[model samples]
Target: MSKIDQFMSGRLRERKDKLSIRNLSTNILPVDFCSNDYLGFARSGELKHLINTNLASMPDYLNGAGGSRLLSGNTKFTEETEQFIAGFHLAESGLIFNSGYDANVGLLSSVPQRGDTIITDELIHASIIDGCRLSHATRFKFHHNDINDLEDKLKLSKGNIFVVVESVYSMDGDMAPLIAISNICERYQANLIVDEAHATGVFGANGRGLINQLKLTDRVFARIITFGKALGVHGAIVLGSKNLRHYLINFARSFIYTTAAPIHNVAAVRSAYQYLNKIDHQLIHQKIALFRNTLKEQNINAIDSESTIQGILFSSNEAAKLAAAHLQSKGFDVRAILSPTVALGKERLRICLHTFNTDEEIISLVNHLQELN
Candidate 1:
């Protein structure tokens, strides 16, 4: 066998031996508890119609974003969509990227110059971590959401300082203490960058995001919003001042080197925001409460979360996987989050509640979980 193939096979075998190997599978489950379509926008017929209407106006010759934005991809629709998002999200300006990963990678890797320092929540998403790695700045991670720990790190940091965090943690489904963190950053003169990936379409007026909802837009240096999550679409944007937008345009390699997302994606994002404004979030909030309450009433030990994303912890990867499989077999789409993604003992069944999910389904899912436990 080729040497490269042998090495790759060996690594995969090691992962399998640990019961932590992952594979892709598709299923048509009866209940929806594993997707990130928090408000059911992904499956909305209305959203599809809106996308179609927007597409109808575009010339038939344009299928792909012909080249990178710097080359040929920067169409008028692209700029308009970004401006619309900025106005809606209460930002001075917005810069669109191909995805949330690209935004974070571009922002983190390029913004912090040499001799600068980055203090991040240890539990922040992998994309942020990767971006930090590519950066020339020194990086330190404090305990997750611990403002005191963050303040201590901030006090010791040298050069320019950037404090990074996620508004709503993707895995744990808990919120960062943004108000307290922002106050501390102000004291330290640190730039605060929030990744609003999971919170974009799940919080604030018209689902602008937690940063906007809390009125901390002015204080934050930048905020990253991804469409694939609650927005139920793809692509992302970095919201900050016009200066920051210009800086990224010139220096952010991920943005410069990558092909821009298609015009169709831009149209969908625009329509998603319009549709998002019309959604009554009260219904979704009620559903989240119902699901959390059901787990409590049944004496199921789930993590404390008011958000739609809830984590039910297990002792090992095997236990979490087994529980997830059993739940899936019962026609629910609950999935296991195993170690490497989370800590070993913190492996879990990550249940995602949705706007379209019925109270009865929530109850049944929780009851089954109780039985499995």
Candidate 2:
């Protein structure tokens, strides 16, 4: 066998031995304790109809973008839709990428130049970490959500510094103190970038994001809004000034080299935003409050979170897996988040609450969790 094949086999065996091997499972079970469809936009018949209506209007609609946006993929309709999204999100400009991963990869790898430094939260998403890795910038991580640590890092940072963090962390579901961080960035003259993946469609007056909710749009350097989570679409956009948009267009490799999102995907996102503007999100907020109260009343030891994502850390990967399996057996779709995805002993059952998730489901899931404890 090839030497490469032998190495691959060893890696696979190591994962299996650690009970951390991953695979795709298509089983659709009764309850959903795990999913990023926080607003249930993915399952919305109304959104489906809106997408169809938009696509039907486009007589020249294609299944895929014929080429990268810098090539043949740029279209008048798509550009106009981007403008609409930017306006809705209260940004001066917006640039869409195929996914949150590509947006982060493109933005991080290109924006921070050779002499720059990136100071980030220790627990930012892996995509953000990968983006930083691809950059030529010097990187430093402060303790997660600790503004004091961030301020200390800022004092020591050299060159053009870019501060990175998620508005709502995906795993822990806790919000970053964006206003405080923004203030520090202002004081230090460092550019601030926030990944609002878990915050979009779930915060703000119109669900713009945490940055928007806090009224710090002008203070932030750039904000990344992901459609896949709350918007329940398939892409992401970086919201910033027109010059920054131009810069990314010229230098962001992920955007320049890849095919732009298809017309249908863009239209669907536009429709989702339209739906977002009109829909009442009070029900979702109520559900979120209900879940929080349920967790508290039951004395569950989850990380404090105002957002929909919640996690209960386990002592070991095996223990988390067992607990997750038990919940799944009871007809809930909770999944085990294991180490190296998370730090050792921080393995957890990552439960995602949704707008469509009923009260009974939350009660049952929490009840099952209490029993596990």
lDDT of 2 by residue, 1-373 (tens): 7999999999999999988999999997788768999889999999999889988899778888889999989999888988998898889999999999999999999999888899999999889999999999989999999999998999888899999999999889999999889999999999999999998998988788888889998998898988898898899999999999999999999999998888989999999998897788777788889988998999999988888898898999899999998998999999999988999889999999998889999998899999997
**lDDT tens string, model 1, 205-243?**
778889989999899999999999888999999999999
Residue 347 displacement in candidate 1 (angstroms)? 0.3
Count of backbone clashes, every candidate in sequence: 0, 0
**Against the correct fold, how does model 2 do in TM-score?**
0.98
> What pairs collide in candidate 1?
none
Candidate 1: minimum summed lDDT over ten consecutive residues — where? 57-66
lDDT of each candidate versus the true structure: 0.91, 0.91
Estimate TM-scores for all models: 0.98, 0.98
Candidate 2: deviation at residue 74, Å? 0.6
